[model samples]
Target: MTAAIELHHVTKRFGRRTAVEDLTLTVPIGEVFGLLGHNGAGKSTAIGMMLGQVWPTAGQVRIHGWDVATQRTRALARVGAIFETPAFYEYLSGLRNLEIFSSYTAPVSQRRLAEVLDWVGLTGREHSAVRTYSHGMRARLALAQALLPHPDLLILDEPGEGLDPEGVHELRQMLQRLHRELGLTLLISSHQLGEMEQLCTRIAVLRQGRKVFEGPWDRVQWAEGPIRLEARPFERAVAGLQAVGLVLEAGRDAEGGWVRPAPGITPDQLARWIVEAGFDLLELRRPRQTLEQFYLSLMRPDPQSDSRSDSREVTRRPAAT
Candidate 1:
């Protein structure tokens, strides 16, 4: 089956500065893919290229197997997007704004307008002037307009911006419903890592206009967090483990010591070794790495490189069970 979105060797340069470089990605149908980066990481630029609003300086972008640059019409026919801050005539009612925007593409029936408004939780507010709407409400209005097309693919740029905790939760639930019931392919870009952790099945991380990581979250090769060991006769336990060649680090509050086992040694092996050595094993805990930790590791500077450059692309493998 054709992918919902594809970018092969895509690059975008603005004069002397590159906004995106050598980006190659694929979003399969029905996947909730995420684009993640700090400001000026070229996320919006890449979204623009996909929307045919910005031409790529090199390579190609395709939507459902249709080239965006050459086959713009067909490529975007079934796509919807809320790129940047969604704009509308503030003086006009929300329903009027939707009607006008929808008219630019195709005629939308009143029933379809009502359906989308309700989907975004803006049903009653549709008749209110957009200027009277709060930021969160305005965002919902933008989403309602995007849904006017009943797009099979939805590309959202910071859809969570301006939303409070409740609003953000609602947005997440609505997007999930669209993908679940309508089978819409979603490409979301946001700074909300925790929210992304819950929403995206796969993600691509961009830095300095370059894609440094792209894969399922489970595939990210996270730095091994230290294992906390609590044992009786701490000094003997430390000496016994160290004598056996297990690398030990100082532990935090209440922990007897921390163990970073060698490549071949497992945590279970360490526990067994302690018991066999006649030391009482009180507790053994390994803290799992979160998505935030993984992202921070990627963004962390490489000690070997100059200050201007990012660390090397993350090496990925199936995470240990």
Candidate 2:
């Protein structure tokens, strides 16, 4: 189980400010690993270092076994990336845009451009001028450029930048398909967290230039439940149920506000209690966590606490220029 990507105490500083600090992580092969964070959480800085677009002030980034900074060409051979603005020559046709990128590919690169176009859902629109293509189309074209060299690792930064809902969905499907079928390891980040949940297998949360959380989707440790869970028919033995350590949700629900244990409680215990209570156990799941809710919970601040620590991060917005 060699990691496809590894960062060792990586730090990137700009003048007196550190964009990324003491960062370390591994992205295993064949997994859709997501880099989650706020606008100034150093995601782009880290990513730029990973791609050789920006040099780290300290530490190192490695892809497969190649050191990104020292062995730039070898390390990059396995990576495809889509950074912020997906640049393109609008005057050229979609196919031509791809063709231009394709010229940079080695002749032996696996039908590279064509394969990526189909993978990104631009098969029929390949001949359309870049100007005629929709925003989504342009993004996909940019993706095709990244895919041009048929790299084993794909790094997409805010991949859904200009895509409509439908376009975003298409990219999601494409990533899943590539990960499952082609054995491509995909690492992506986006402000569109809701969409990321549908596609990423594991996610790393970064805040204020440090790693806060990293794990499978289900294993993300949030201090509070994102959605309210309700179980109908409270058991008469409420005291006994509480003894098992499931907290009562403390709010009014049509059924009951008793919160279920996040990962440790068994449904059987509640189910049996419902039977004993002489009522049917109907719904047992919470509402799905929205991107907004999950992100806000992690970035949530202590109102009275000094804001000086992350004042820079909280106020920074994505580049609109």
Candidate 3:
């Protein structure tokens, strides 16, 4: 099947500075794919390229088999997006704003408009002026507008921005239902790691415009590194592990120590070794890896490189309305 989205060696440069560097990615149909990166990590640029708002300096970007460069109108017809802060005509009523928006696209019925507004929890607020709406209300309005066309693919960049806890929870629940009932393909980019853990099934992390990790959430949670153990006779267990040539780092917490086992060492082997040494194993598991931890590890600058350079952030283009 053709991918819902594809970027092959996509590179974007602004004059002397490179914003996105030879990045490639794929998102399949009916999947919630996440794009994670630090500020100025080229996430916004990459997303802009996908949305056909910014032209790539090199390579190609495609949406559902349509090349965005050559078939932007066709590709975008099937896409709905809220990039960065959603902009709307503040003077107009929410209903009127949506009417103007839909006028530029395919004509939508009143019934359809009502359905979408209700879907986004903006039912009665449709007649109210946009300027009177709170941040959360405006966000819901933007979402309602995006769903007006019943897009097959929805792209949201920092959807949780400016949302309060309740607003965030509501947004999550709404999107979850939409994705489930409509089988919509969603591409979300955000800094909210915990929210991403709940929303995305698969994710890709980018650092300095290059992909550092890409896989299912479970694989990312169990990424390779160290296994932590809280076993009895801690001193003896540590000594035994060291005797076997496995490097162990003392755990920051009181539970146990973390072991970076030898190349051929498996968890099972370590368990046997612990048993043989007469240490009662209380807990033996890989250190739980959150999305935030995984992202930080990738973004960590090399000790050999100048640390000052890591603090410099690239400016991204304004988000498309």
Candidate 4:
């Protein structure tokens, strides 16, 4: 099956500044893919190129096999996007704004407009002027406008921006329904790492205009995390573990310390080693690394070198013995 979106060696430069560099990405149909990075990380530039709003300096972008640069209309025919903050003519009714926007592509039927309004939970407010709507309500209207095209793929740039916890929750639930019920492919770019952690099936992280990591969410979990160990005779247990080649970092409390076990060492092995060494093994467990931690780790400077390394190649660091 053709991918929902594809970019091959896409590069964008503005004067002397490079916005995106050699970005090659593919978002398969029915997948919720995330584009993550800090501010000025080239996410917006890449998205703009995909939408044909920003021309790339090099390479090509395609949407479901249609070249965005050469066949923009067809490439975007099945794509809907809420890029940056959605704007509307505040003097017009919500329904009126959607009608005008929909006409730009192809006039949508009244029934279709009603269906989209209902889908975004703006059924009753459709007749109200956009200026009267709150931030959340306006967001719903923007979403309704996107859905007006009956798009197969949805691209959202910071959908949760300016939304409160409840509003964000509603947006998440709505996006889930769109993917589940309509089978729409989604490309979301956001700074809400927690939200992305919940929504994205696969993710690509961009650092300074280049992709540093791209893979399934579970792939990030394979990185080695600290193991919490609690054993009686704390001093002896610590010394014995170190003697056995386990690297230990002092814990917050005195009860236990954190261990970064060397490659080929398991928690079970650590427990066995402790027990056999005459320490009473009280606790042993590896804490799961959250997406935020993984992301921060990627952003941290590598202690061994000043150069940047591909995250995929070194996501899992070997434990020092």
Best prediction by TM-score: 4
Off by over 4 Å in 3: 229-254, 257-282, 303-321
Model 3 lDDT per residue over 1-321, tens place? 999999998999999888888787889998999899889988999999998889999999999999999998888887888856899999999999998887666789999999989888788889999999999988988898888887999999999898999988998888898899999999999999989988998888777777766667676666556677777877678778888776444443454466667776778888888898799998777655677766665566757654323322221111111
How close is every model to the real structure, measured as TM-score? 0.78, 0.77, 0.80, 0.81
Residue 64 displacement (Å), model 4:
0.9
Q: Model 1 — which ten-residue stretch has the worst lDDT?
A: 312-321
Q: After best superposition, candidate 2 residue 158: deviation in angstroms?
A: 1.2
lDDT of each: 0.82, 0.71, 0.81, 0.84
Highest-scoring model, lDDT: 4
The TM-score between candidate 3 and the true structure equals: 0.80
Better of 2 and 4 by lDDT: 4
Of the candidates numbered 1 and 2, which has the greater TM-score value? 1
- Candidate 1 overall Cα lDDT vs. reference? 0.82
For candidate 1, give the lDDT of residue 43.
92
lDDT string for model 1 (1-321, tens) is 999999999999999999998888888898999898889989999999999999999999999999999999899988888855789999999999999988776889999998888778788888888999988888888888888987999999999987899988988888888888998999999999888888887788888888877776554534354677888887778777888786554454553466676666678888889899898999876655566766765677757554233323344322232
Task: State, as a TM-score between 0 and 1, how close model 2 is to the true structure.
Answer: 0.77
Runs of candidate 2 exceeding 4 Å displacement: 89-105, 108-112, 121-134, 221-235, 243-255, 259-263, 272-283, 286-288, 303-321
Ranking by TM-score: 4, 3, 1, 2
- Model 4, range 244-281, lDDT digits (tens) per residue? 68654435345346776766788888898988888898
lDDT of 2: 0.71
